[model samples]
Target: MTFTEQLRQENDDVFQKIFTHPFVDGIGRGDVPKDSIIHYVKADFEYLNAFMKIYALSMVKAKSRDDIRFFFDQIGFVLNDEVHPHHNFCDYVGVEYEALQSSSLPPTADHYIKHMMHHAQTGTIAEIYAALLPCPWTYLEIGQELLKTYKPTKSHPFYEWITFYADEEVERITLELRHRLDQEAQDVSQEQKQLIKEAFRKSCELEWKFWEMAYICETWPSEQEASRI
Candidate 1:
């Protein structure tokens, strides 16, 4: 089976859950509350900041200029075209962009960001790719499926967000990166292959939790903090 197919086979449960998650399904139906989506976008903005860092580090790890350029291009798009536009949506949904900027990262977002950064900084190029694949690839897949399920309308709050992931250029980039990672994996030892798969699975798990974190609007526990006064 193709590596991408294997990834789907191994993570089928998460694949199903994420696509069918109430938050995701609601977005497709245009029924998710504006406040709920606003909550999600705020956390997502913080997540994308770290996502760009991983892409930058991966660029340093890449040996080929083409690969390096790919990573660099991803960073540019995520920061400039992909993620930043959410701020406009946030404003429309009652989530202030400046407020999200000042806010500290919540518990789940902090842990997930740290995990991705750790792998991105320390992992081999292929490993870094494995760790980073779930977010973009899954989002792209979700976007494609949702576009089929519900035709885009300007009235739907997430139309632009949904449309971004489904863009042909973005889909092309995602597939190209996936093929590159799978090709890189072909020469690695079985142990290393397992490690890469574990990274893939763990990253998928984090993606799953991130959605839950948004659904619940998870925050750092106030009572858990030590009292200074």
Candidate 2:
């Protein structure tokens, strides 16, 4: 099997959990709570900021012009094309898009962003690809799988959000990333391949945790009596 295939196989358990998560299922069923989506959008907005930064760092580490352009184009896609989903969520729920810009990162999101940044900043191109693949890859898979089971009507609460990720462009982008990672793995040492594997798996786990974080609306505990620090 190819490297990308192996990565998917190894992480199938986590991907299954993400697919079956209440947040995802609710979106498919059009019954998700607005407050949960609000929390998810806020946290995910922060996550996307970190994601773009990692893409920039990957551009710096990229060995070929092709790889650099790949990252650059993806950054553009996120900045220009991906906002529709966030807007859909906010507009439906009566929240301003601007509010997401100022939202704080939930603890799980913070950890996941740090995880990707660590590899982007310090790892080889191969490892960086491995670390980053899970986001787009799994999201596209989620969208595709969800789409397979239910076709959202225009009036569905998450119609735009679901269709956005299920778009052909999203699938193309994911396949491109998978191809790039598989190509990068072709020349790496065995030890390097292991590092890539580990990064990929950890990222898969974080992907699942991100949904759980939103489902539960995670936050740091209040220190009510310590106001005057």
Candidate 3:
């Protein structure tokens, strides 16, 4: 079997555990109230705009032609055209692309972007995959689970949004990245391989943190409201 397949098989239990975690359950429940989720989704879009900018910059800084091309293809074709269109994720999330072009973002978001860029610039291609792969992979996995469990109806505001990202394109991309990571893994030194694993773990943790931040933002009540609820 390919390294990608081997890793997937080996990590099946780990992935299953993550899928069943309470935090993911909370998101899948869609119990947070539509307005709150919308607000958080908007914030997430703003966050994504910042993310894309850094990704673009990293593309420019990429040492290899393949890396540069891959970054551009991901951003231009997948993110911009495929994912963003379903919800106008930027507009719905209240982030004008032009404004994102002009302004700064939260420190945490900036730090995440910087970390990914650093990996791209200084690390091996496998290291870069380790850093970049988790975001989509997590989304794809969660999306599939959610779809199986949570059938969307008209009552759900972002059902389309959820469905779009969870669909075939993202799945294909995730598999492609996994293949690339596995192929590149053989070429990396032992220390670098360890670093790649560390980076993947850190990236997954960061992803959890990102969702946690959204949940926190959504759950926070105003002082007056807090007293009532």
Candidate 4:
């Protein structure tokens, strides 16, 4: 089996759970609360900022002009097309884009961003590819699968959100990342493969928490009033 296929099989539990998660399912049924989506948009913008930095690092660590070009193409998509829908949705929902820009990440969002940054800053090109594959890959998969049943009509509350991930370009990027991961995995030791799998698993778990955080409208908790004497 291909490395991507193997990774999917190994993490099937999380993969399936992510697809069935209410935040995702609610989008399918057009039942997602506006507040939930708004909070999620705020947190996700921060996630994308970190994602852009990692893409820059990926370009620096890339193996060839082709790889470099590929990274640039994907980065452009993220900055331009991928984030465009957020602006429209934010406006329609009465959320200010500036507020999203200035908003702080909830703890779960911060944790995921730090994890990606660690791999981008310190990992080998192979390892970085492994670490980053799950985000776009899994999101693209979710979009495609969701659309199989529910058409993302223009009237759907989260239509912009749904359409962006399901776009052909996004799928292409996801496939490119998977191909990069599989190619790099070809020469790595089993230990390296284990490391990649662990990173991917942690990322999937973080992704789940991200949606959960928004569903519950998470924010940093207040400090305790005082310690008991």
Candidate 5:
């Protein structure tokens, strides 16, 4: 099988675990309190907008052809679908663009965005891919699994939204990004491969943290507080 197919298989396996994960299942099914999920979504939206700004700036600063290409590919997707008419995250969260533009998010959210921007600006194109790949990869994996597991019925409020993100479009994007990464990997130095692995590992951790944060935000007490209780 091709490298892309292998990556897809790996991603699929990981996502199966994620979809059945108690935490993911809880949030996806709206078992979490409404207020908490709203808070998480709102905060995430604010962070997303800030992330977009930093991403744009980083792309501007990208010196190498590969770096510029990676930045533009991501920017195009965000602008064309994720942020605009095709799939407005703000709209999904019931927040107006103006509100998202004006609002401040949690420090953790800021840190995550900053980390991604820093990698994009200072790291190699491969490094940036290592950093940025987790979010969509994780989402797509969970989405595909959810598609299989969660039968869409009237009871599931966000079924359509969930399926949309995890469906064909997300799968296509995942394939595209993985292909780019594998191609870019060939050009990177051996030392950079280690760095990319470290960065990718960190990126994955951060992604896990992000989801945990969402779960915490969706629950009344923080995860720590919940644990203590």
Candidate 6:
């Protein structure tokens, strides 16, 4: 099996947890509260900004023109293509996309972004890819899983979000990145490979936490609560 396949197999438990999470179930059922999704969209909008920065870091670290181009394409993908779902969410809930731009990253998103930034700043390209892989990869998996049981139509509140991630074009693009990571892994040392696995695992764990955060509308304590603590 390929490296991506191996990573997926090892992290299946976390993926299963994400698949069964209340946030995901709610999305599939079309009953997730607007407040929860709004919280998630605002946080994720900030997260996507950090994601682009990490890709920029990776582009700087890339050795070859092709590698640089890959990162460049991905940054463009996130900037141009990924935001449409957020727009859809905003439209459904009557939130302005511009407002999301100014929103703070919630705790879970902050942690996940920091995790990827750490690897992007200090790790090898393979490790950077490993760190970043789970975001899009798992979304693809979630979309696939949701499709198996839920048919999203125009009436579905999350139809755009569900279909955007589940699109054949998106699956194709995501798998291309997965295959690229596997190729990057082919020549890495065993120690580096372990680091890659650890990065991948942590990101997978964080992905699940992200869903939980949105489900509960997790946030930082208020100033008074923070001062007391």
Q: Each candidate's TM vs. the true structure? A: 0.90, 0.95, 0.72, 0.91, 0.72, 0.94
Give stretches of model 5 more than 4 Å off. Answer: 1-23, 54-73, 83-101, 218-229
- Model 6 CA deviation exceeding 4 Å by range: 222-229
Per-residue alpha-carbon lDDT of model 2 for 136-178, expressed as tens digits?
A: 8888988887788888789888888888899899999989989
Report the backbone clash tally of model 5: 0
> Candidate 6 residues 203-229, lDDT tens each?
999999999988788888784378698
lDDT digits (tens) for residues 1-229 of candidate 3? 8655655565565566657755556556654443334444545556565556645766655668886777777776544654453253344455554443433333444456667777867876677788887778888888788777887664554466567667898898788789878878888788877888777766676666655554454333354387797
| Weakest 10 consecutive residues of candidate 1 by summed lDDT | 220-229
Q: Best candidate, TM-score-wise?
A: 2
Q: What is the Å distance of residue 58 in model 2 from its true position?
A: 1.0
Of the pair 4 and 6, which is ahead by lDDT? 6
Alpha carbon lDDT of each predicted model: 0.80, 0.88, 0.64, 0.82, 0.62, 0.89
Q: lDDT at 90 for candidate 3? A: 46
Candidate 1 stretches with Cα past 4 Å from truth are 223-229
lDDT of 6 at 157: 85
lDDT accuracy of residue 172 in candidate 3 = 83
lDDT at position 127, candidate 4: 75
| Runs off by more than 4 Å, candidate 4 | 223-229
Q: Give the local distance difference test score of model 2.
A: 0.88
TM-score preference between candidates 5 and 6, better one: 6
Residues 139-216, candidate 4, lDDT per residue (tens digit)?
A: 887888788879878887767777788888888877888898889999999998888888888888888888898888
